[model samples]
Target chain A: MATRQYSFYPGCSSQKGASSSNYLTSVQAMCEELDIQLNDIPDWNCCAASIGYAGGGELPRLTLSARNIALSEEHNPGQEIVATCAACWLSTREAAERLHEDQSLLAEANQALAEAGLKLKNETPIKHMVEALIEDIGYDALGAKVKKPLEGIKIAGYVGCQTNRPFGIDGESYENPRYLDKLVETMGADSVPDYEKKVQCCGGALAFSEPEKSQEMVKGIIEAAYDHGADMIVTPCPVCQMNVEVYQDQINQTYGTKFKMPVVYYSTLMAVAYGRSAKDAALNGQVIPAKKLEAIAAK
Target chain B: MGDLNQAMIEKYRTNFLKEVEANVEEGEWVKMCMQCGVCSGSCPLGKFWDHPPQELFMMIRAGKRDEVLSSDSMWMCTSCYNCVVRCPRELPITHIMHGLAHYAKRLGLVPESQPTAAFAQMFWDNLMQKGRVNELKLGLKLYFMNGFGDGIKVALKHQKIGMGMLKTGRMSPMEAFGGHAVKDLKGFQSMIKKAQELEDQRIAEHGA
Candidate 1:
């Protein structure tokens, strides 16, 4: 068994019964089954999500994320920091890059860290769990682990904003990211090639604040998935899943349509394909339950 | 246009571009925008903004302080960074919009009844208080902060989502009633306090 180990940063969303708990649970199960050792960083704080960007100046937001980077450095020096939540991945990666680029900001952030007796080197590689899976564990090795190869289940690969914007996965087009599609295909599922809203924003943190606008964005994404004959939409971000899934009923009421599309994590599919049971994958926690996926896993 | 209004425009001293660049970290990068319409065009919500990104930058440069700050344009920015990646000048357009929103909030210029601005403030408050946000608390605070009637109306509308959250184990009963907070509250508070102090010191240097 090949062992891949790294510092795991589970953001606030990973707390018990939070929006991203299932994503965290499913990803953790998938990682364990795949032989990746994730050492959880002790006492990790919130990533300051979009609200940090919304209400505060740059230094405080950078400082908040820098503290996490500093902790990973202390606990698991030189090891890559892996995050399942897209917001956390974006926050940590963006902070490190900004600090690295601006010496003054780096000094300021470090000074704030000095108060906590921590100083960030900003050297640890921060990545989304998807990037680690694609780069570190190639799909062929992952493909070999599929005990129940997904068959006849058409999945729309929704790569939301953070994974590929500003800093994208290796060889990914910022405008049209295909890494998710390829992963779906490698898992023995049909990838919707012409999914237009694949790289579109699912209205991030604004889903709570501006419901009307966010619902429209979610409609565009989900409607496209349904229009393309997809049984389910698989994503890498927990926020996307929540925003996309939670808004469907309201969206349906508003638009006079019947769209109950299941928004699930890519790890959910990977776990099922890798021979993990549906319950272990946390599939039951899915908001709009995916009957097709569950039946395939059962087969 | 320059000949007719030069005196009138210059006399008002409405030019806020310099102040924004000096004071706001994200706003500093907006000075590089070359009036390329790419940002406006790339935005999903661009059509909704009264002043699209290109126009907003132009107005900012032209010293339209009241018009720029009071406009709903910044409030509507979803921070998708579509413009950030496509910008020829490498300007962080999304961040600039967000910075402008923060500036408006600081000045009490955000239009009343703007939920996004309200939600942003609530979100920050929760994070600052508990060191991390509890979803239920954040949700309740957001809907109810305005008034009881408004809260119930919004709650009734979103009840399905709430029930679904409970059903799926995504939100536990305890979490729904009372949400989770950071374990090491002291450490979290201190880090936030230190960051706030450093940020305040920097902002003060900008001469308010």
Candidate 2:
């Protein structure tokens, strides 16, 4: 598609030194190899994530995201707003959908925007970066860009909650979405398709609030990957990566299970598949040492 | 405990479903819920709730206003949309959960002891301050919110992950101390102020 360009919404997670900084850095490196250009939207605000839903009113949630949308529209014009974070994708997309569906809500959001001299026409479609690769660049084309396919590594694709339910990738099943599995296959890696916790909730940021239950859920997810003999669990969301990897020690201490499963961004795998350096893929950002991927990349 | 039971059986209490549908954002969808256990079954923290999601919806319907609002079920939803996707009725069960949470929170029904609710409020406060969230500040604030002694214990507990984050360059003290997350802080705050103004007016109009 002549080097497709997208308006990038890094959200808060991708900010410098945040949890998903490596995820963003690696995604960008992968995009470069795949001939995709990500244009950063100027002064984009937060995606108003679960906070908007969990604490604030509906209009406030819509308004908060609408400001970002209005800015994206002004900065990038009519280009699609592609969010790297799954929470950003869901909430921003939800705001866009809400604004589009209700005229009164649209008017109200616009009113909120009018004060800041920004208004959303509600035209741009919000997409997750994974969807863009599968839909815009196709798996065949994506594989064609791969200079070094992950041949022997067994990757269990964990779609988590955001990327699958509500607004899933095109042609992906809700019960057993294989887009991540398919992406892994396209990169010439062995995908653990039978991995049971592919769509299980990673408990989101509940790990911070209700750590015990969330850690158990994380245990189920990581252990399922191990059960299927996956070398690493690859996910699209940074929050999932943070919860999956960061909470492992806590889970181990509480549950008395010794787990050393490595959770990595799909972009890290994608970047490596495209022959980007392991360093460029930010493999060091993971809480667990990515020894398997490091060994794979060395060979 | 006796007073709580008395409040639950009181007929003069608020019509919970009516309040939800009238005021809560996505609460109108609660009526479409078929009492199917899909939402409750799909919830990862299903057993943790005083009343599981399906039963809570029924509670809301039966005008168990005090009981439904006071339950931890709303606060327990992690914003994972498992039930929303699996719902045969296509009801947005996740948003409904959020709506109920917001409704309960707005009315001060949620207990002061709820950590999840406290974290969520801190999340909102963080975002409102900077139009962004800072993990370092957030973690510290969350800890201190629980009292200093407990916060220290929690910090000590998480030191391993904290060290991992530091070594991996995911958490930087420089960014924590000096970074400005919102590029145009003044402009962003003005934008938020306007949004809140509209929201305040909207709620006042509804007398909610």
Candidate 3:
């Protein structure tokens, strides 16, 4: 297949040395295998993430994402803007949608953009990486390139919030998004189609601000995965992956329940299944080692 | 800040719902809620909140301004958007929750020692400096937010995770000095300033 191109927005979490930097690494490797080109939008700023709302207000929050969209429109021209971070995709897409609906807001946003020597035409389409993987690169094509199928691994596809709600991928039910499970099946793993907490919330940014409440929510997510008899959990959002994986030790200590579930990205799974090395797949980034996938990669 | 708060109270009188409609982002949607309670039921953290989304909407309509504004319930929203999609009235419940939080912050009515509000301010301040977040500084600030003594305790508790992150190269100590930034820092700051000013102007006009 011909190489498809997209303007990539790697948000704050996926930056070098950031929480999800390994996500960026694995995505780069996976994209190369899939014959896709990701061009970085020059000097993209923060999406002002969901947590920023309290201080960022409305217009400032919208402008932050608008600035990135404007930069992509200017530099990458016709390519659609793709964000691997779920928050970035949601923020940027919300900005684009709101701007298009409100002409006055668009005018005001352009007024702010003008300070940065830019203008937002509000014409670009913002998408999450999973949308691109499922729509642009179909499951059949993705499955065809899997050099080493993960045969024995039992996987629970965690479609946590942001990507699953408000505006889910094309034709996906909010209650049950099957794209992640389908991707798992394509990689020849046992997909737990009925993972009860598949669309549950991992408490997003609140994991840092309200640890007790957020950890309670995270406990439910990880506990459900274990109940499903899954070897590991896979997710698309960096926040979901981080919250569910990193808090297990603390949760175990607090709740007196030992949990050691490895929460990894869909890109990491694809990279390993495509016969990439553990380093190439950035598997070392997992706080709880994905020992199962690591063993698969060792093969 | 208190002056704006006082002036807003006098301006809106007892009509709290109308005041919210004029001030909050997507505040007008609050009136659209039919009290189906799906948003409250759908929220994963609803049980922990003092006032769930449905109760908050009810309170708003009941003209419980001081109680609603000072409540910490809205800060519990993780932006999971479950409430948004499940709202039978399509109230944009998530945005309304955030809008209420922002409005309370603007009026300086956020509950005292609210962790979410405090962290949001720290994050905004950090981002404004370099156009991107210096995660190291922000994390350090969060740890020390309560006091030096408390900060030390929290830091020690999470030291293992920090070391693990550093060992895996997921975080860098060098970032504490100077983190990533947009190339046109001046322009970015000015654009943000312009947006804030415009928002203030819009709010002023609405008040007028």
**TM-score of each model, in listed order:** 0.94, 0.95, 0.98
RMSD of 1: 4.1
Clashing pairs in 1: A17-B170
Task: Give lDDT tens digits, candidate 2, residues A1-299.
Answer: 63799998898878887878999889988988877888888888777687555566788778878988888899899799899899999999998988888899888888778877888888998899999988888989988988887888898999899988789999888889999889899988999988999988878878788888888888999898988888889999988899888888788888888888888888999888888777888987877978877876676
Q: Determine the iRMS, in angstroms, of model 3.
A: 0.9
Question: Scoring model 2 with DockQ, what do you get?
Answer: 0.63
lDDT of 1 by residue, B14-130 (tens): 657877786555777767888879998999877788999899888888888778877888778776778989999999887788888876666567778887888888877777777
Question: Residue-wise lDDT of candidate 2 within B109-174, one digit each (tens)?
Answer: 886688788888888877877888787788889878778998899889888888999899898787
Compared with the true structure, what per-residue lDDT tens digits does model 1 show for residues A79-162?
899998888898889889989999998988888778777888889999988888888888788888887778888999999888
Could you tell me which 10 consecutive residues in candidate 3 chain B have the lowest summed lDDT? B199-208
**Stronger candidate by lDDT (2 vs 3):** 3
Supply every candidate's count of residue pairs whose N, Cα or C atoms clash at under 3 angstroms. Answer: 1, 0, 0
Global lDDT scores for all candidate models: 0.82, 0.82, 0.91
Spell out the clash pairs found in candidate 2: none
- Candidate 1 vs 3: which has more lDDT: 3
Q: Per-residue lDDT for B105-152 in model 3, tens only? A: 998999999999999888888888899988889999999999999999
DockQ of predictions, in order shown: 0.57, 0.63, 0.83
